[model samples]
Target: MSNPASATGTAAKAGLTMGALGVVFGDIGTSPLYALRECLQALPADERSASILGALSLVFWALLFEVTFKYLGFVMRADNRGEGGIFALLALSHGEHQRPRKGGSWLIILILFGAALLYGDGVITPAISVLGAAEGLESFNPNLAQYVPLIACVILGGLFLVQYKGTKAIGRIFGPAMVVWFLVLGSLGLWHIVETPAVLAAVNPVHGFRLLAEHPTNAAAILGAVVLVITGAEALYADMGHFGRKYIARAWYFGAFPGLVLNYFGQGAWALSHPGDPTSPFFALVPEGPARLVLTGLSIVAAIIASQAMISGTFSLTRQAIQLGYFPRLQVNYTNPDQSGQIYLPLVNGALALGSIWTVITFKSSNNLAAAYGIAVTGTMVVTTIAFYSVMRRRWRWPLLGAAALAAVFLLFDGALFYSNLHKLVHGGWFPVLVALGMLAIMHTWKKGKEEIFRRIYANEITEDELCNVAASDRIVRVRGTAVFMAGLARGTPLVLLHHVKANKVLHETVVLLSVVTEEVPAVPDAERVEVREIGQGLGVWRVVARYGYMESPDVTALMERVRDTGVPVKLTETTYYFNREMIITGGDTRLWHWQKRLYSLLSRNARPVRDYYRLPPMQIIEVGLPIQL
Candidate 1:
């Protein structure tokens, strides 16, 4: 007889593994629709069979080395409190510093750029995946080719529209659908592979080397297409926090990897048999019949799932950025009450929808969209490799030589893929780059402007003794009820609290100065979340520091409840929340350029208000305006 707890654990792991298949593997699993076809299309027609085998060989090893070894084996281990992503890696690399360490600005810039590139990936992934699947109609019927873009746009619109419902609801349907999808992928490929058993020889790495050696000039272009095989690899790490490393790895090895391998080789076998047939090997694998239509429909569904994964990842990344102070605050909605990770951002969704739909309408074909795809993926991959090195050296405290040797190996592959995609810059690759640059600018400005504001506000800070003296002063009127002043700085009096006392000449009978700090981790345990300090001998002036992980949003009401548990006389109903609303003036003296200052001001103006972001009650909230010039 087995233990009941063991059985329950096993069942839960299996459920998570299934969910991982739907969310984590969707992008890479759908690559069979276009990855092999793109590789073959990039090669010479005269040497069709050899090129097919070589491309297959390259794709095979790329997945084995890049995804299986580098990411899942190494980078996932660098997770920050069980959360993984570029930002998580950034936090780990910086050690325990809430702020960047000395000379860490460069690393922050690099990581921010990596994050910006992901937004680029988010835009292109949806457009290309849906378009690639929709293009299957061309093989189904030549006349239907013209309707592909329209169909893709409609699918994309619906996908974004349903985001408000969140991923937890959609993942339920997506999980089983993907299981069937992968089964079909493997079975179809296996059928073709048996017909041409020789295709299995491509498993040898020599075939991959030979392809590149023979066509040295075309090697870059060939690798550029091959990079598509592992484009979704980063999602594995980015979404690791949602699904554990064990479940994601289990899903990859058992489900995604085998299906993808068999399909690519099957496509290779099909390409070899039908030499000079200019049809897409993916769609051509099925004969012209109702079966082809069924496969096409499955392809579209799979494509939508792929797009959904990217969009969801973008939402998670944006939340992390905003909480970490790299980006301005945006309205974040928790889509699932049970899951904090499942969130939706309206502005982010709207922007992605417009960008994705515009991409579909403009490119009109997956082939054109593919030109814009690899650059962003490879660029982010390279950044991840570099950032991983920092984690190994600093966080893991690995030996210098050991870290260098391992990072160099990964960087070699990353550099080759990134350099190969450079030729695509003029051929629609500029789309992602343009998007990344815009995002980089906004992030840099927000970070810089925030720092300047913090410095200016705390320039002439008051000590606890000074605040306590003010509390004891006879000139000050003690009003009834409690007042909660939100402090930006964890130490000393907040400028807003000081200003309120000076301007209003009145203090609450019980004053609570609350400071919320975002730590360099994913989630803080509730026990370690709040710290309280009492000021003066008997005065009711208190300082509370509430610590939250970058993954969480602060709730003043909940925090106060926690404070009340600590024997403080704080009541949520009787408490009035006070916030500092900064009015950004761009023309003041600062290191920022005229353009950046203006941009920073614009972002600040549009940022979500502190009251809404912190979930403070509207009736008891008071906003104190403070003018800050940049």
Candidate 2:
């Protein structure tokens, strides 16, 4: 929503297929080779026959219901300024009913927490998806187990190896390779399906329902199996900006959806006919010897494509989070603007690479790793459901009955995955839960910190006219250069100014009280953009409100350049920027949890390097330390 020149300039109305393929399909595309396999691996010893069929059935329906209806059909339509993601949805639903339904004002806190957990999931998905695929090397050669760690290390290193150069170089390989990956998956699954025609019986939703009812004791885990199919479906909705809604829909419906369904059912068919085979269901589907060699080779390529997609998606999500203020500002390198297929985030890339390599070594194989994967991924899906319900009621204006019906259906599916993964709580599931908890702490801490600053700064009301009168007074001393005052309130007093006149006896003309206000709208139109008010005299108050799309960075200097033409007779030379340097005052009256107070202190200090992050001139920056405790 910022200018195209901001980062990889895909127009607001640019074509979306290529972008969607590189971004949206990354998580889902890799499912073809693993979703069914993981579900079957988790099945109980005695229930192989029924559980395998059930897992396949669940994967099929999960993809259809989660990706097709819940997200693509309805959620994508709710994009804010053609941008999609949890934050965008929150922006769309903001102020629709003053505060949200449950305890009202607390809803923002809930949405922020959900998004925080999503960030944790983003970190894990790439690690697990790639690690699971690289495990394929062992199935080809049992002796390869000794070398699995080495092989995984190489893959992980190679993955991060290409990130700095940007996605554009490898993007050409993504779509075409994914295309072949899908075809290979579908054809292999189709061949197996033909061999054992009865596997198609799982298509009936009743079979899925029957599988659970028949095996009540194992139903939760069975449904948990299917949830893997739709694990990445959330990304499709989250990355609407990378690829348009329509293109993602087309890609899923035409390419990814069919390929996944075929591969899953085919795995089920292979398991049924060749019941004695002990290897993974995926390997059993392939004919022996040279054919297995070919399948293994293709599987590796498909896995790489899948890994690339997840890696790219992670970069994009981090970018979105940083722009929305939920994440610390990150360094972004843009590869292709004509296409939304290329981007690189150094911090995220490094974190994911380390995490993936560590996971591979820790779990050793996909079978062992399978237990931990479902929990983090499903937790994200459940949150997506919560966010989607909000979308239905507010954005779509769906009736109570309609929203209830869809939510009820999806919640049932979510419940199964949730309960099943509960069995995995100790076995790797805790990591994601732990990660989510950490995310909650960071997000809530930031929210409370932001509010504390806003409330303190906004309490005192000072208009441009008041500042102008004070500057024009006979007794006031004047300082040269542009006085860039940072404000917390858009319509009230700014702490920087309040501190300025109180502490220092000097006042300067052209006072700019810049309050970076994140709007409910993703991109505010230029006319409705920044609110600039000149209070006459030489003293001017520019309430330059910065509105950022979830995918934008709010650079104060860039906005300053735009404000110059709006009646303020100010030149940009020798400008000085002011910030409230807060010191942690522990022994004082407070209104926050003790732990939250401590966290706020730490975050305030660590928040993006103020000068460099904001692109301000380092030598021109000034800090006025003021201690306050909430």
Candidate 3:
């Protein structure tokens, strides 16, 4: 018999795989509701059967190559400490090319844009998914079509409202619900497949190629619509941390992929039998009565689940961005204290809520929103493929030919999707592009402004020897207890510390100059997390450099413990934290333009206090205001 402990471990892994199914697969799983119908809309009425088969073939191969082979086979292996996404990929790629190189700026730009593009995705996915599902109500009664947008808006609002609770409470049922959703998707498709077994022939690659060759003009349009099937492709890699690579891969291969394939082929079979029917082929698979109603309800639930995943993903992305210093510090709440990833950002949530609600109200229908959708997803996919290529070459030490070959195949498909989606720009596709551009501006400004501010702040930084000399001199009096001075640079004394010593004319008996550095990876190993150095010849003046990965939230109390573990014992109760609060006056900036300075100043002024973000006790923390023009 198997060991009881081993059995429990196996069972737990299986459970995580199930949970991965619910959150990760919801977006792609629900694509069957509209992806096929939208693709068929691009086909000529005269050759409906051939077009349906070809489109189905393309969808099949796209999933096979993009999701199955490209992601699971290759890109998943480039994960950064269990976390995967554009940012994680950037960190992985940067591991080898640590120094700035010729193409480094372009690579960084692409990665930042790829991340910014997700906001566009966050807006479109919910509007389209929920709208697509609610549109199913139209199948039962055509008069219900007018209510679809309103219903979708209500659902979207409700989904955003609950994000504050995090996914902990409702996440339990996500796996089961999505499992049933996929089963129904497959069963409905299978039910139709039995009636029309010829749909299976679409699995062959020839039909897709034939469509591309025969109707090159219309193929672009069809491909644009077909790309919808893989819209949620990034979530597989994005949520790799929440569920391990193995579990996500298993969930996709065993649960999501098969179900999606069956459903798409099943829709194609149904469309072949009933050509020129304007009704949605997905709901049409179920008989027009109560069964369609049930499927519609399931579709709505699945869509909401998809929206939830995207919303939660935005929260995670915002936290990572802030931790990586690409964005200003925002208010982050951890709903589940035990789970670090289960965070909620109110600013991100409000922005997404407004954007999504505006999308629903503006588009007013899934079909309209569909026009705006694919660009961000396709752009992100292209960036991901490129980032993966960089990793294959630099980190994995793959031969140039091998890396180029891998990149060429993936980019060919990704480029085609992105090129085709460009047709949407005039017809509402501008929304995501605009959102991405706006986000890029904000991120670029914040990063540039922060760099300039740091440059100015560190220009007068005193070295360890200088600080040691001052500490040993009789010019300064030593007080009781430790004063933990937070600094931007690890070695130099913080400006705030200088200000404190100059004004108060006294220093703490035990001075801990704490510097927290965010490294490029997801999580730093505990052994490398803290580095303590004696600066004043055992005068109790020590420099502590605490390194954190981008995925981590720094807890000063914990950092103190680590410092204490290194023989520098300190009590948090007695120690006071010092921070420099920069009063940014934007008129006299060194590099930034007037508008950029104003924007950066607005962001700086509104950013959460350094003490609060670091989780220091409000009472014990003292902020020294230093006015600076930038």
Best by lDDT: 1
**Per-residue lDDT of candidate 1, residues 1-630 (tens digit):** 111123257778787888889989999989888888889988987887768888999999999999899988999988777788999988887755445653128887888899999999999999999999999888989999999999999999999999998987777877888988898999899999999989999999999999999999889989999998898999999888877788889999999999999999899999889888889899988999899999999999999999999998899899888888889999999988887878899999999999999999999998888877899999999999889998887777899999999999999999999999999999889999999999999888888888888888888899888999999999999988899999898788988888899899999888999998998888888889999989887789999999888888888888899899898888678899898998988789887889989999899999999999999988999999999889
Candidate 2: C-alpha RMSD after superposition: 3.7
Query: Which should have the higher lDDT, number 2 or number 3?
Result: 3
The TM-score-based order of candidates, best leading, equals 1, 3, 2
lDDT of 2 by residue, 1-630 (tens): 323223344443233454456456767777655667766765677767766666667677777777887788776787777777777767766536544332124555666666666655665565656656655666678777688667767877787888788766676677766777778778989999999999998887777777778878777666656666777777887766655676677777777888878888888899888665677677667765777777767666666666776677667666665665556556666676654336677777887777677777787766566676677667766666777777788767889999888878877777667778888777786776776788677766666666666666555667756766766776777767678877656665566676778777677766777777665555666677677765564454555676655555566787788888777655687688987777765544556678878887787776656666677878778878877866
Against the reference, the lDDT scores of all candidates come to 0.89, 0.69, 0.87
lDDT of 2 at 623: 79
Sort order, lDDT high to low: 1, 3, 2
- Model 3, residue 324: distance off in Å is 0.9
Backbone atom clashes (below 3 Å) for every candidate:
0, 0, 1
Q: Which 10 successive residues of model 2 have the least lDDT summed?
A: 1-10
